[model samples]
Target chain A: MSFEPRIVGFLCNWCSYTGADLAGTARMKYAPNVMTVRVMCSGRVDPAFVLDSFRAGADGVLVCGCHFGDCHYVEGNHKCMRRIAITKRILKGMGIQPERLRLEWVSASEGARFQEVVDSFTEEIRALGPMRLKEWAFIPEQVEAAAAAHGE
Target chain B: MDKVKVTIDGQQIEVDDGSYVLEAAKSLGIEIPTLCYYPYMAPYAACRICCVEAHGVGGWSKIVTACNYPVWDGLEIYTDTPRVINARRTNLEMLMANCAPVPVLHRLAQQLGITEPRWKTDTNYTCILCGLCVRICDEVVGAHALAFINRGAKRDVSTPFQLDSESCILCGACAKNCPTGYIKMEEIENRYIVHKEMNLSPNAAITLPFRQAVPNVPQIVRENCIHYKTGGCMVCAKVCPKDCIDYGDRPKFEEVEVGAVVVATGFDSFDPSPMKQYGYGKYPNVISSEEFEVMNNAAGPTGGKIVMENGEEPRAIAILHCIGSRDHDYHKYCSRVCCMYSLKFSHLVKEKTSAEVYQLYIDMRAFGKGYEEFYERILDEGVNVIRGKGAEVVPSGYRQHEEGHLIVRCEDTLIGKYREIPVDMVILSTALEARQDAKEFGRKLNISTGADGWFIEAHPKLAPVSTTTEGIFLAGACQGAKDIPDSVAQGGAAAAQAMKLMAQGEVMMDAAYAVIDEAFCSGCKMCNDMCPYTAITFDDAKKVSVVNSALCKGCGTCVAACPAGAIMARNFTDEQIYAQIEGMLS
Candidate 1:
């Protein structure tokens, strides 16, 4: 495959996850480049998880959550909101495009809004090609081996 | 039948030989004042108010009641004679003495120039003992609910023991036929007598649902029909020239097989009674949009008059919008069609009546073609467009009140001031809500509904009419609140979509589901928590995550979260997505 800008999306189960599903349910067509990963809540997404996706050759990372209030797990989405801000700063220090990381709010009912957010985010990521963090990144094999051993 | 000649007021008239003198006089255009002589029943001349001079054929003359006395050949009947006038006067004076000066008795007394009664009873009563109510109960209705109880002065019309008779059907036939207006019907406990425009029309006992109802037939409201209750009044069947009225017809359920089903069950207008502030059911002239629409209809109970409950033209009319919609406590979703229809109501009210129209709405969503222009037109016509929700409706409680009998309280958001508009009528443009049994109907069709109970479509933009079910479709307000044009377009689209399903005859769904490579799995069980549907389970013996394909929604969340690269989404794998991403960047 030619050089590609792979993007990863971590969507929360209650709000953003259903919101993207609502986009499909609402039939709001948009760019289909971003790969989605669903979690129980936005709090479950770690900053290391965003780093890991980039290490696995993703050019960008998008974290989605419920609107900024007491969310799925009381303050789960709020915690995610604060985490993404720090993650963006860290990406810039690591010689990556800071704009590659984005945090968006998509309620369960805002299907058209989700489509607009996704389309705009995809365009921004496409402008900055492959992350190339993989040039000096930690290997997936090493991380998998460590995780499997820890389970045992 | 042999005809006989008679002289009434020295004018010769002919009639059927055994016909009553009242009929002959009526044929001669002479009106004889009579009571207790209902033509439908045998004339019970309890009140001999139609007395006349009848010179018999044998040269002997006597005074007789014209209502029951028969005319004979050479019979000289004089209705205007002094003797006839005196006799009628005497009979009415006696009735006037017995009963209270009711309007019916007073009108008859005025016709005879009787200033006052010669005698008076010690105790005055309402009933003249005309026996019309009792006769109708016994002879016509056959309900026998009302009977002459006691004797002489103490006699009155009453049901047996007067304690909510089990046999009393509450049919109001006696009340309708009672001429004195003394026999009024009382409301039974649980059964509601529907008002003028609320259910059907005021005359819903027998009416066509509308002038253009398909099958073009009149239906008898069995609940209101007297014949259905007492099995006595076949009046409609008797009077109908075509004799089409059938008391035997009953509703029957029929079933049919179809390739596809279209659910366009429509919507019910939101009832504003639940919001106690509106005072819809608690006050007069506060009407729902549906009731107002019916009232505007030419064939409606008021005959298309935009009048107040007191049967007078309204001075000012207020149209309140969004009764149960777009409110945090009631329904959070916009009803979507209220703003446009409220504008239309203002236009109609302006057209039909000289009443000043006021439109109170939070937001005017005139989002359709010419809808904005229509709003502009109403504004030009001097409709007061207050940008706010109507808060409450109450009686105006003013002194000089031929107009402005009710007051509408609201905050004008545009001007940022509290406003209370006094109006004679308030029309609530209530929201359109999903039918009460929409969920049950959705379940029967294997479809789902959104949180707001609108049927969830497969995709709104692409398949707006198709439901989540394979061959089921949705149209009109059942999907969401929509105006007439939108609903019509959706109805046509739904028909076409259902047609396409029937033509295909079978379904074709995507088979893209996540699968695990047995050699690659490291058995960490990390992917089990990733499935939102709980479709993945770990096989204890194999020590690997197993995905039930039937339950998988193919969202690919588990595939991306898999640590050991064991799980990959089928058809649209990570590698395939990377290829598309490459093309997008290029």
Candidate 2:
């Protein structure tokens, strides 16, 4: 089968999720490869969720939240940023391609930006092909080792 | 109140008569895992994690949720028996099976020794049917926005009909109490987050005042407002408790008659973006002092935390003084407030943050009362007061940390050497200048502006507040750069002058008002129309225009507009102008 990147997006309900809704209402066509999972706030998204997405056969993961200072929960996006930064660092050390995980800020009014980000990120992920975890058989040792290293 | 005997985990404890088993267990130091139960809220038995085996007086034994089951006389409760553990484990397994990805559920399962879930994994939902949010929103907040929708496995908590409800206050109480973090309030409060990278400030379209001033009014800035820009997003109007918001409100104009006017229009902060060497607009951390003041304000973006753009507390800060002020290439005059405010920044930075502050200045102009004492106090606080003008702020080459530091390049005049001080933040104490519309405003008020564009005072010292125009006065920084004390003094002086003018029943008129020659006057009505003050009126019977001396200020517009050459200003007649020109030529 031709390679189609499976991109999982964890979108904060206030900004990015609403932005996606705006994109739909505007009938802005973007890549259909990306599927979104809505969360209350970006801060609610644990780093484990991003890891779980990759483990569950997602080729790419996108965590989008409200812009800085624009978080619905005052500083939720700020917390999201700090956690994502740490998660990216952990992903890099785990030998997983850190580029697969993308964190962006999309406000509620940025419908065009949502379409653009989705299109660009989908194209970038398509170029990278399927994630290594998806192709490899369930190797308990390697997965456990990677998880242990990330836990540190 | 009466006490009741209750046995929790086989330990007999006396509790309030109406207390639940969970509270009685707590009185006897028995631990019960609770997810949906909160002390401030009514007991919600949605999460059955606190299930316990209860024994009745009639020798009946059964499993009951400790959160809602009431304590009674001679009631026995078992919290950690094999049957109770099995019951709790079954409940946790069902929760884990249904909400597999929720970290809180997984944590609770692990704590209860339910390492592996027996049922099939379902990742479709994260909420464990915890009704804390629903209960709190309905009971405490009084906003019945959320409710349990659907039934059984397909059940979910949502706004009625899954539509954006009008009753939602966007108070975020539901989101705050949600154990699974599902109900985001972003839909209700559609505030666009502006300037994300810079961490500058947070603002809504229609916002309340920053400080406690009289009337503490909220105003709408149309440009950034969503309703004004896109004709959408009336969330502010919807959420307002008093329903006081009116999107239909328009700008209004009214005319008022006054004997005197006090021009207290203040100055504007100089924009330093044009000074590329400062790296103000380019650098994320290099901010103006006004922005710093907001950042330091308790009600500001970071809630008064002195953090850099990237959320790191600055280890060192450099306060640059005399930016765009006291420079011949820009403003020629010293912005009198910069030096003191720069010192204040130094004191605040040192007090708030652990940052080592460097005060860069051309000279310390602490000339006001107790100002020198404040300067000495700041000096005692270990602030590095350097005598030098900051040349430029550039990124430091030291990449010791992930975030690069900024280096302030300046000549240390005291040491006669150039020094590059690395700091995380640089606050530019920019100069205050006349508002861009000062000239137009001066012209509209018929007041003379100085060569520097400030409103000219009648006299430099004796009549500082009075303008060249008889009935108008100038106050505060509009006339010159002044600190709070001087501005307040000038305001008082201007108010007193206005009150003095109002107190006088009659005012002396200048002897230079326009006069109409009835013999040569024609009733063309051109002069009457041309008079700005409406001082000239046409006489229909005499066919001549008459001048109202009391209303005229001798502008002589009617003299130029008169087609018959019949109007003449008393002091500015043609013969007097010719004499003045002749005298000037001689």
Candidate 3:
């Protein structure tokens, strides 16, 4: 069977979540690769929740928030922006392609933009293939064999 | 202005007493060439080439310049007399001796049958020193910035002391009137003079709105008018046939009683300066599609030439679509007219100039009839259509010296690679959004506006032209973003709806309204702020919010905001909503 990417999208309640509902109501077709989790606000998301989704075999994680200053709770999306920046670095240190994690902003009225961001991010993750931990784990013997293959 | 009789070449003619003999000769179809005479200015008979023999009533005759000689009663003028012809020939020979063989002089020399001047020819002198430009500058323009310097052998026209004078308004009157084409207006200061106060001014004070207009008459732009500025120059008033030109007339409000109102207030183009990355207001060549449209108009400043601000044709042009349309930060709705107009602009540029055209756009929505075919035709016309939103415009040229260019950055989504194109001009297809005073206008008309500031109609599909207000109707871009065809269709529908209401003498209101159950009511008053139409008001005596039934259309906002479940909309309750949900599930 061909490997289809399973992307977990964390959408906030005020902006990005309503943006997803707008995309559905507008009938704009996008890739059906993402499973959305509706949080109260983007600031309510924990960094540990991101690692848990990756551990649960999700190929990619999408964190969406309100645009800057458009948060329903005033500064909730600003907190999410800072948390996602740190989480991206943590994913990079764990030997996963940092391209698998994306932080986006979609206002309630931008249904077309939400669809575009979803389609493009899905295409990007598809090019990176599956996230297999066995293949990504760095062992000394495999590294030496890869180094010897280059005649180093 | 009094009339007088004068005889020219044995034909008697009546002319204005103060008018010159040249005008009388012109009226009589007698041609007498004069180099120093301009029609709009006072005549300086420096050339003496229009010499004619004037016979007094007492049979005495003498030679005189026909240009400035005033005509009187019983005055006989002979234009072909031998003495008059000899005087004109001698004057032309003396003027040609000092001036080089220019086209104006050569054309006159051919007519007079003069192969060469009798005196030595001086190739060093190109100017004929006729003082036509000097008289036009002093008498007509009222600016004495240019004057003749030195004397006799070294005479020349120049600015005061041959330096840039502060008195020079750069009006180019002297340069335009220079007969020998020796005068040119050079850039002695910051060349790009930005006139901030002018609004879409093609620089002419009086102009037609377009080539084909309803009234098809010229209107004066009072802002840039020289008569209004100096309190002089009543040239238009002097020439008006009906004498209907009134400079004192100003814009005023008019009151009219109407049975119905069609609110067809249109949209305004989104100003791209706030976007910042495209550098619209910062760069010289980065102009919005609205400005580009004006530049492409036949009667525009450059006469429809698609040229840069420097008056040079652009080598390449980049058209960026959806500038503020369909974007999260600016406007979420597409300005439906921009795509077709941008394509038309590309077609015009290709037809007019040999410039390379590039269009960067996201999702070309040519959904209208024959629009897709036009898009296909544009594709066949060699326009490079890149399916991506233009991200930035960076000035990347040393343009002051020569062909400077701007770099347009985009993703090029079809190729899945980031690309930057360098072009001489960038035309931003800006969006058409709601007018700034739309909300206030909606309030004055007792209509409701949506989040995007467009007046909300009764229903998008059924009652597209009807608003919640009974006698008021919506039309064109006032209701939503629409193209010309859709706006015309909706405007016609709105006009018919209004006429129907006017003819019927009444309008039917929506029967559904919200009511508050006083038994379960609390003094919360939160619904007063939540109601979009201001239909709910707090009663100070009862401490409970009351619903104005006459104003309510049962939008159900108070029903959802009521914490105690006090408000119940007519024909729409929680049970009814749940039943509708169940039906949808089925």
Candidate 4:
């Protein structure tokens, strides 16, 4: 059977979410590995969400928001960028491949982008193979403590 | 603890895993030409300047944006290759022809060894539509003023259809960052016959709050606007210099779907008015740190003259520390700036007017480079350093009715004595407060604010300049109270963050965007027009509108605007949001 990765995508309500809708309306063919979570701003995607997805069996986590300076809420995407940077580092500290997590800035106009990103990130995650429960073994208590420290 | 090995420019380098190409390149001292990349902002790939060639199995060799590209194990990347170089050069040439000035283009042309324009146009504007300035101004500055006005061949950078934009804060950012010289800011003042002082309150025209500001131009405060007030008063237009105050303009609601988001909203200063004990409103002499910055500035009120209300140079100046900060009554956060700025004020006052300077503080925090030494030098100059918290600033009652000379009451905690020191001037170091309308603004953008009112960053320590909003950046005194060094550093950092994103010619977005349940969709086309990033389209053939994921920014305006409730935002579908809401209720 072909490997179907479970990808969790975080879409900002303003642009990315609508772009997906456009893709669907246009019947754009793409991968079905993605399960999207809508956020008001890409900035709202807590690192907890990304890590939580991994904890909940998501093979890849994708975060989408407005183009830079294109946020409906002003600088929310900027905040998301900074957060994702630190999150990637934290994810690396764990046994998780940072490449499994992606942060991108796309506008509502690029439905093809929506299709492409999902296809690409899904492929990347698939290439990385599955997150090993033992390889990523962490004392849940320890991860919780770290998450608390990072204020995730 | 282990470093991952990646090859760039045929050189093997060991960098920590999860490192981006730009970060890895920087570690190896590889200088990549970038325009719209900032570390604080996520990789946007808008400019297509940082394109590099990568060769490997399953490695698509077409140019990929290096800024956003993640470094992988056993990945062979070429930072400089003929195909990649040509693409970059062509992209830059198109940009140059569109926006760069003769000198910058000429120099670049000389370096690239191109003598003439391949696609020559006879236009005077020299700004390449790199979108760096637009992204920086909107995302970093949080002003949403300058943008790419018009599209394609008619695409010119202007404020809402080439009108005098009251929206622009005149931050001079567009001028400061234009790679090409097409967008030169010429300050032209329009004269108006004066008459409305008595009818106006102090806050009436506060929209132009930055008028008489240091970088003197009109900075229209959007929240305090009459349009925002009662949605009335287009007064800014009636009395604008260069007639550059357009109220008829609104932000373009386009959307773009992406795979990831980078939150880089910066910080803002704390306002100290909650402690009415400082008498900020009642005492004309007491001013916040920013106001004092403007006051002491050569271009500030009183024209940089260190004079009291009586129009006399202060014989003795009292500098109060931590008006709204470090006190339990106000913000518990130490405004890392008060001490150094207080000393700076003391020096400026002493140098300009030779006044006796007294610095009253809870504790002298000179933690920066040359700061302790600066404290010692100020002491050597005989500036009185009192270790105590100031109690209050009252009137001396010696001068004219409103011009009563000021007196500072303080408790010298060390000496255990209360000293009502007589002084000609009292400088209140006010706290940097969050914007009053932060919550509403956050709601509009689908982001949240911290309890302290400042836009909360994703990670306080690791991500200092980012907020909870994606594709946006915070800079200057908007995220939190910071010193000059930190603000400037953050500003440049925010710019770099944006550069990284825009540097990618095109961004890949997540598929978690809205998927219209076509049967439910009413074909209203509201989402198509309401999108701020222009990410939606109507398929006449399909008889239903479609959203372009690359263009959709995911603002739920269309979802809310949908009368049929057909347009549902993804990831936050009506079902999921309702489930969460229902769970909360339970």
Candidate 5:
């Protein structure tokens, strides 16, 4: 069967969630690979959620909110940006591709843009194939050696 | 319960013990005239307008002011007897003589059946020694700017030293309370005189904010108002049809609890004064886009004629875009409205005046719907679209009538050469910046601001309107730079989000709140201080820290900071996090 990436999307209530609703209202066709969880804010999406999603066999995770200055909760997106940046680094250390996690800003008015983002992200994840956790065993020395080999 | 029986104006009335005679008479619906007896103020008893004959001890009747006189058991008060009327009439005549030309005193005299003052003085002083101004200044306002100066016949109200007192805040409280209107405030000779520098139409000191909004809603500009600055000039109040102008109106603070909050406090236009190359404030003809907007408005200074400060229409106009915007020196982000508004200005200039228009911009960004079409239409209208950032606006050295003419210097990058376009008026398309109070507002709401000072939303894309703080949302320019349509759409979206939450009836809090292990707790109170939301409270009697589930956001800051390992975040405990990592690898 063709790889259909199972992506967990944490969408903020104010901007990105509305953008998705707009996409649905507009009937703009896009990939249905992402299952959205409505969060009050992108800032509310703890790093643990992303880790938990990966452990639960999700191929990819998407965190979406308002643009930088356009955050509904002023500075919440900034905290999201910082936390996601750190999470990406941690993902890289864990022998996972940082590309598995994505943070995007889709304004409420950008319905078309939201469709484009989801389609493109789903395509990219499909090309990377599924993340099967049962195959890889975590050995501290081997992981360190692999990280050193990767120069990370 | 002892009650005092008092007969006022031939009507017997029962009153609470120790009630004043004025209170007793008021209970019986008997009218007692008073001037210097303001509510919540100490009675001065200066006017004596409420003089009434009270039956005294020894079968004698003495006239006393009803406002200050206390009622006693079996007291009989005559408000309008022949003796009382005569005494009141005599006092009214004396007051009329002292303040003859004053309208309020004249009205009081007419009511007392006195046509004119019986006694005349050479000075013709309007002060009746009511002492209302002096007493109010000291007691109510706390300014103590006025006092009863001199002694006996020479005693009059004056500020200490009779010079401009430094303590005077010029609140106009004393003038407002003056009974006879004897304290004359200096009136501006011509309040409708136009601002000289800008050459704009004359605006009343207190006038409607705009012609479109409610026609009669007047706002006072306290800085330019003579009444606010010098305790003079209440001409606007005197002429108002509704008599709604109140000098005593103070800012009132109110608190309200709501499920959601939408902050739409808009943006501030960037001032181009700091950009000396623009010569905005220094040159009379060089103006901001807002000034141009006003000049283009039909009800504006020149009645929508786009004329120069000297009242002459410009022969050529140069509109500069991205002023203090899209540059590392000022704002790094492109203020989205400037490009389109500059095009609009070009069209307006061409339509209103037969002037040659030039648009100087680094690049044309027509990203919005119908915006690119608008740009194309402006091009069709024969606007000279220059592909370069205007460097400097300088005075044209041409000798013949060079007053309004300015030389705009820029490199025509497309043509590979520098060009100096001489135009009569220069318009700067200034940037829109976050409001100066955005930081203070963010602090008040317990929300955080981005580095650029705009409110940071919960998520940049998904949660555009929602703040980090739940139940609060942002709309319009408060979030970022947005045009009217976008702002309105955001407003509707925010409203809908709030409605959705309200319709849900209950908010589902995160199940990851902190749980305290009471057995392992050492009774140390460190987590209480670490909680940013004040969710952790140390129970002094129980010697344990309690977590408020509703208030806690499950950030795990307290969990990590706990010394005893007593607190564990629900669903995010150390064991759960380790298990997730183990599951990720195996």
Candidate 6:
């Protein structure tokens, strides 16, 4: 409980980002557990971004934008979803919680939504604690010697 | 709360005492032809096609307008009869004698078996003087520029003292309200109907009405004329690559002859701006759902990137659902398109950058096929889905370490505590609203809409695309708020409806049109002057006014106003109606 959980977020330029502005204008406060990145569309968020965020020590990540059919890039959000599905399976195989990665859709006018997702996700990550998968150390010398013996 | 027993068409029925006959009939799935009876607006009873014979109080039967006439205990009503037919026919005949020569009226006249001359024609007649135009202009438009001038036979519609009244703001109230072509609408060939769609900017307003309007050419509203604002600004015309905008000229009417008409009028977006707490128009970054689409579009102002108006990419984003929808404060209907769209935006923002994404919604409605899987995928993609409606959008005005961004505040219901998260952006999934000009368009087509601005479908489930008008159909967002798949499906459905009519090679119209009573027609020609459709024609050889069956809409204005009771609507004879009244009375 004393340790801080790190969360990464990808917000669409149009709806979700403006929603964050609305939150600021309203003076609403939520957990400072999230780091954010802006993208033209949620659909444009490549799977690599989530994997990279995890590699960069993020315990959790969030993606948000306008509602479906309401996407700024038209069908960009749809593509983001398809790509996310593939990445979810890959993360599960990698011994990650998979729950640490999350996707949320927010619009520019939804400031309250911004607060809700951030506050909730932060708590969720806290419950799960820091991602220990990246923290695990492997004995590189032993693995190298074992690999050489097996090959020779 | 006791039910009132009433008899309609020889059947006893129970209805609420205060309910009108039309409402009662609707409850029983009865279709009644009516105009000037919009549910939102006050009933005028100007078009009396729904007139019925009712009795039971002292056995006294009388004809009454069904829309305004309330139901009573032991009341007997007759909707159809030989007598009713005569009255309906005679009324239609009178209306035809006065109507303008529009095709709809002529067709109605043909159905009623009226074609020959029966009354004298008036030469100096164009306006129908139906009083609908005047009332709607005053009541609906909230502008009193137009009024019926003069008195008796010399009565005419004018703006004040017959000159170009300065009070006439040219909002087109009189023209739009006109039942007849009396206040001729200024219809330029390429001019767009400005208020027909959701316009985010003044530029959008100017270019709203163009057909096939993707990147439509903009023109200055003549009344809100930028030239009038500053005395000389031709920026729109100058910037136009096609030289499509003509600033120096006023809108003019151009008549075109066509075998068919396709009404492709689109829909509008819900205005969340009125909910000032959201800070829609007040905030620079807080944009409408559609504006955000434009901002995120490659062809839009931002060239396909998620950024604030200041051109900086956001670090965090939040999406809110159900603006102007499923709320008692606004439309109490679930806008069938918001949920999936929220998911879509979530995926999009996450894919585009490393920013955190959050979806705030009252409910996660992924009922559509393959939608639930998509939702799960988005959740797995590291986007946070919060199950709660947003309470408010406020600015913490926090900057120092966050590069100046907004803080979103809300109670995460699942966790049972308030949360404030600083994010660079927020998005509101605003609901789709009805077109502002829906009423005007309905008037032109002699159709109606629901209490909300969406056009009323003939039947919600069975006839989703058809309208009250027999040949007309609705498609896309015009009928209601729907996703792309549904919109496209409706578009095809409407096309199929039109194709069905065209494939039949003939349109079967209402056979209850007007017929002239040659014996009673005093050759007064008053009816000839009042017809809006111009269905009546005077024969010099016959010395009597004639109606064209193929053009009459059966408005029945001339029938009631007729001094001689000469013309009548088919299936509505005076004698038959009198008999029905007598029968109801006893």
Q: Going through the candidates in order, what is chain B's TM-score? A: 0.67, 0.68, 0.69, 0.46, 0.63, 0.55
Task: State the lDDT of candidate 1 residue by residue for A1-152, as single tens digits.
Answer: 65445678878766777789988966889777777877656755667677667766677888888775524344556667776888888988887788988888886667787788888888888777666654552456766776787895
Q: Which ten residues in a row have the lowest lDDT in candidate 1 chain A?
A: A68-77
Model 5 TM-score (2 dp):
0.54
Error of 2 at B57 (Å): 22
lDDT of each candidate versus the true structure: 0.78, 0.80, 0.80, 0.71, 0.80, 0.69
Model 6 chain B lDDT-worst window of ten: B577-586
Clashes of 6: 135
Better of 2 and 5 by TM-score: 2
Task: Give the C-alpha miss distance for residue B204 in model 6, angstroms.
Answer: 16
TM-score of 4: 0.40
TM-score of chain A of each: 0.83, 0.89, 0.86, 0.88, 0.89, 0.87
- Model 5, B243-344: lDDT tens digits are 889988866898887888888888999999999999989889999999999999998777899998899999999999999889899999888889999999
What is the C-alpha RMSD, rounded to one decimal, of candidate 4? 32.1
User: Tens digits of per-residue lDDT for model 2 on B166-258?
Assistant: 766555656756787766657445744321221111244555545665577777756545455435446567667898888888889989989
lDDT for model 1: 0.78
DockQ of each: 0.06, 0.00, 0.02, 0.04, 0.05, 0.01
Q: Positional deviation of B141 in candidate 1, in angstroms?
A: 2.6
Interface RMSD for each predicted structure: 8.8, 34.9, 12.6, 12.6, 7.6, 30.9
Model 6, range B1-586, lDDT digits (tens) per residue?
7799887877777987788887777776766555345443456676565677777688788888778888888888787655655565566555555655445445545755668535434433556555665665566545566788888767777778876655444445456445445675443444533333235345332644443367564555555543443343344555568887765677789999533344557777788888877777776777677777777777566777889878888888888888888989998888878889888888888887788988888888898879999999999999887767776777755556754666666778898878776777788899877789986776566445545677766556778887655787888887777788888888888888888888888877667556777778777787787565677666667676777878765544455345687777565444543443233222
lDDT tens per residue, model 1, B1-586: 9998999988898789888998888888999887677666777877788899999766898999888898888999888878888888888889888788888888998988899789876565778888888887777777877888888768788888767776666666676667677777677786554222223553557877776789877788887777877788676787788989889989889899888898998887787888999888988789998998888888877898888888998889899988899988878888988888888888888888888999998888989889889889989999999998899888876657534488889999989999999888899888888888876776667565566777767666877888645578988999888888989999998899888877887756447678998789888888787675688999899988899987765656566557677787777566665554344334
What digit string (tens of lDDT, one per residue) describes model 4 on residues B548-572?
7766656555665566777767776
* B131 Cα displacement, candidate 4 (Å): 59
Q: Indicate the residue-level lDDT of A7 in model 5.
A: 84
